[model samples]
Structure formats: structure tokens, C-alpha cells
Target: MNTLLLHCRPGFEGEVCAELSELAANLGVAGYAKGKAGGAHAEFVCSETGGAERLMQGARFNQLIFPRQWARGDYLALPETDRISVLLQALADYPQCGSLWLEVFDTNEGKELSNFCKKFEAPLRKALEKAGRLVEDPSKPRLLLTFKSGREVFLGIAETSNSALWPMGIPRLKFPREAPSRSTLKLEEAWHTFIPREQWDTRLSEDMTGVDLGAAPGGWTYQLVRRGMLVTAIDNGPMAQSLMDTGLVTHLMVDGFTWKPKQPVDWMVCDIVEKPARTAAMVEEWISGGHCREAVVNLKLPMKQRYAEVRKLLQRLDEAFKAERLRVSIACKQLYHDREEVTCHLRRL
Candidate 1:
């Protein structure tokens, strides 16, 4: 029970490990992380007893950049015979869970275990109910059973209110055929990830205005138009004719990095392929200078030290905002639709 399991994007295991290890150290929870390069999961094993519990209590899952989902628990070696009894016995020592989610890594082998997990759920839930270890109380903690294989599993627990609403921190979003490009999904996902659904009407209304930098091909701009927003689409390259036909966009041929909106807009979005630092700085300028009340930007990460760079860039934003006495809320995430990049959202509080 001294291990903290984390799920992340495959191939980013090192970044997740580095970030979690640093975070654990900051919280005075000494631990070492272990994971393969493309394992899609990492484990931080605390040397001190109850260190995992301390880390879980000290850190909020939303503040972590790399890990999609996390839990504190120990491994369960499933026996070939009477596996359900073993699972029941292990869970007997833990508190009752409000919900249960059986999961696996994002790898192919993990996917192969899905059917086994699905089949195991019914009997397991029946046994848990019979044993008084499962309940329907939403306020209680959730039992997360992450299976590496049919024979091995990580039985963990996380508070439902603190963990991601989705199983693996992934939102199920559908791509719209009416959109100009597939890139539209990235912005859509960013909004869902950063903004609360209940606030969508007030924050993203049809009467609002927006500016889209590097709006060529009109992926991100399409999202604004879909919201019935009047958008200034800045780019030198040609845009999608279908989007142009909407008559809600004003195309400006200019550099996204250098161009500034003449009037303060409700929203600003940038998806230009540029240095992460530069993008972060520009986003700060937009919010601090009152160019826009809110912004969503993308940062293209480098091949190495991606997590470190993201941390540095975010820290820079924090310093700048603090110095300028700006009250803003910032959130960033590597969305399901994003690749080698992260989406950032900044809103003035």
C-alpha cells in the first residue's frame, strides 16, 4: 500500500515519472518512480510507510500536468483459482467504495484484458455488495481496479470529487463532419477540459467575439463560428472555403505572434506551431494587456524534457501574472486530440 499508480499517455512515462517524483519531493514524500518508456503507466513507490497517503492528501489531481489518473494502493497478485475470493479478501481491509471502475493501460495488451475485466465486474460487484464493501454513496471514495493482465491487478482508491470524471482522464468527444478540419477537435476538447460545463452559456455565448491566430484551414476558428461568435481569423494562408462561407469570420493576413487585436475581444485562440515559451509569453500578454478576457493557446513541445519545459513555461506565467497584479485562472492539458503539444486556457477572474 506504499505505491501510487498513475496513468498517462503512452511514450510519456518518463515525463510522468519525473513530474510525479519532483512533486512528491516537494510535498516531502520521498519516493522513486518506475515505468517503461511506452508503458502508459507509472508507479511512485514511497520508501516511508503511509507516504503515499500523505502525497495523495497534499496534492490535487487537477494540478498535476502529466498524470491523467492516479490512485494510492498496492498490487494484488491474483491467484489462478478463486480469484474473486482473493479480491474480496484484499478489499475487506479497505473502506466501502461508492463506485468501481475496472481499467487497463492504453496498450494493445491492456486493451486485450478489457473483456476479462468486463466479465469479472458482475461477479465482483455481487461479491462486494454481499460483503458490504460496495455502496451507492457518491460522497465515498472510488475503487479503481487497474489490471495489467488477467493475473495481475492494482487495486487502488481515489476520492471521486478529486479525481477525473472520466476513467482515464479522457473525455468522449465526437468529431463533427461540418468542421473544416480534424484539428477542430483539439479546441473542442480544450474547452471541455478547462471550462466547467455549467458555465458554458455565460462564458461562451453567441453574442461574444473572438480572434483566432493562425486560422488557416479554419480548424480552431470553426469552433468559434459554431458558437455563433464573430471571429477575426488572422492568417496569410488560405482558409477553408466552407468556413468562409459562414460569413462570421474576418480574415486578416498577418503574423499570429506579432498581431494584436485592435479591440478587446471576449476570447482569443492561437494554434500556431511555435516555440512553447513564445506561445506562453504571448498568452500572458493577451491576458495581462487586456487584449482578451480569455484565451486558449497550444504549445508545441520539444522532443526532450517536455515536462520540464511545460513546468518552466507555467512558472513564468505565474511570475508574470503575480508581478502585474493580474487575477487569472490558468489550466493546461495534453488533450486526447493533441500530439506533441499541450492546450492552455487562461481566463480573467
Candidate 2:
């Protein structure tokens, strides 16, 4: 493989290219990146043969931000009539894939191919299985076919363990009707992306207490209440009566930035609209001050230099944690529900 296909937010193609170029350089792999504005995807082409494979083997997908999913392969143009046969032949040398995900980009044009992809999947799966190019084993690499057009596709390999669980890394979540606001999906998605399902009950146990900064309308606090946790909702605006009626929350009318709990809580969730630097500083202060054991905060990225800004903000937190001698695990992701902000999860170990 000499090219890496990367998926990112629709307008963040430049960020993906910048991230990949930096990552490839660090891995000592010479590669060039390119993508169109608002394409929702990017590609990295290696200057040397095998460099793509080398970079893929060396880079950790979760560590890199911006790109939700990545695959390694060159594009193929197939005749529309016999595309299945063309695909099977292309996989002659590939290892048996554990699974197959026929995907499209997140753009409008990409969505148009969804129906065709759905129709093509069953026959293709049967054909691959019959040919022994696919198996039920989850330990193997996954076969990824991203269709750009009826006659054009990107046939690639996605490492099962190193890749996102969802196709295109977009987790399909049904917005809860009970949620006070649609913004609640950000926290829900963050948990799904950063924490393991099996550990949810333990980490988010019953009776655990949490605080919601800027919690007006109680959208995020609704999440904590539903989980059987007591919450202190901080905001100047009135909260939803449904959440207040739950009897699991304490609504405090105050500025989230200036408030502090009497004692540390189990968790602190923030969604204040502010500059990325300010948001980062808020999260860092809460973490370093032992205000909460864990936190989920949103950083509204600047219009320019977003990736570079994120790196600096994260580094600031890293340095502060080191100076405080705290063992903290921090992870951040741009959730599908998130607009221009990225969610960050911080847990003290």
C-alpha cells in the first residue's frame, strides 16, 4: 500500500492533511497529503514504496486527532456491470478480512451512494465468503470499500484493533427524547468514544455525584440524573423542570467560570461556549486543582490554526499535570454531534 485514506469532519480536510504530514514525518516516512475543501476525507501518498504500510504500522490511530478513520490502499476503477468480480480479483493477495464495511463520505454526494452500497453489500459479502477472502474472525484486518462513484472505489485494509469501530468513525446514536437539549449527545458520544462499554457501570456507578458547569437547561445534567447520580447544575439561566423534578439535581444560578463546589465531586462536565484557550484553561484548572476525579469538557476551536491550537492546549495541560505530579489520562475527539468544538475526557489515575 502506498496511500492512506483518512476521514475527517467535512470542512477539516486541511487539518487532516496537516496532521498526516506531521505524523508521517515523525515516523520517518516521506509522504505528501492532499484533499479538497469540505470533502470530508484526505489521502497521504508515500514518496517511497512501502512507506504507507510503514507509517500505518507505526502510528496509533487513537493518538492522532482530526481523522476519525483511516485505510491503506490505492483507488480502483471498476466496470459497473461486473464490479463484484473485479473486487474479488483485487483481494486475491489480501489476508482474509474479519469484516467488510461498505462506506461513503459524509457529504451530500456521498450520502447519495448509501442506497447503492446497501444493495451491493449482501451479494458482495456472499461472494467474498465463498472465495475465502473474508471470515468471522474478529482478529483479522477489516476490508474497507469506500465508494466514490459507481465505477470508482477505494479498496483498502483497516486494521481491526487500530481502527474505529463504526464505519467512517461516525457512531450512530439516537438522540434521547428525554434529553433537555440535543447538546446532550456530545457527552453521550464522548463516553462511547473514550470509555469501554464494560466499564461504564463501574466508572459511572449509581449514586455517583457530578457537577455540570454552564448547565443551563440541564441538558448534560439530564445525563447524570438518568444514570442515578446526584448533580449540581451551575448556570444563570433556568433549567428544565423535568430534570429538576427528577430530585437528583441541585440547580445553582451562577456563572460556571467563577463557581466552585465545597468539596470535589466524582465528575465535572462543562460545555461553556468560549475560546479554545479559555476552555482548555478551565479544564486544566479543574484537573490540577483536584476539583473532580474526572471531567468531560468541550473546547470551541478557533476558525484558524485549529489543529495547532489544540496541540498547544493539550501540551499545556500535560506540562501542568507533570508539574503537579498527577497521573491523568486525557483523550479528546471531535464527535459527530459536535459542531466546531471537540470533547475532551480527563480521568485521574
Global lDDT scores for all candidate models: 0.90, 0.89
Cα RMSDs of all predictions? 1.5, 1.0
TM-score of each: 0.96, 0.98
- Best-performing candidate as measured by lDDT: 1
Candidate 1 residue spans exceeding 4 A from truth:
none
lDDT of 1 by residue, 227-286 (tens): 999999999999988888988999999988899988899999999999999889899989
Assess candidate 1 and give its lDDT.
0.90
Clash pairs (backbone) in predicted model 1: none
Q: For model 2, what is the alpha-carbon lDDT of residue 171?
A: 91
Which stretches of model 2 miss by more than 4 angstroms? none
lDDT per residue for candidate 2 within 93-130, as digits (tens), equals 67789999998888998999999999999999999999
Question: For model 2, where is the 10-residue window of minimal lDDT?
Answer: 332-341
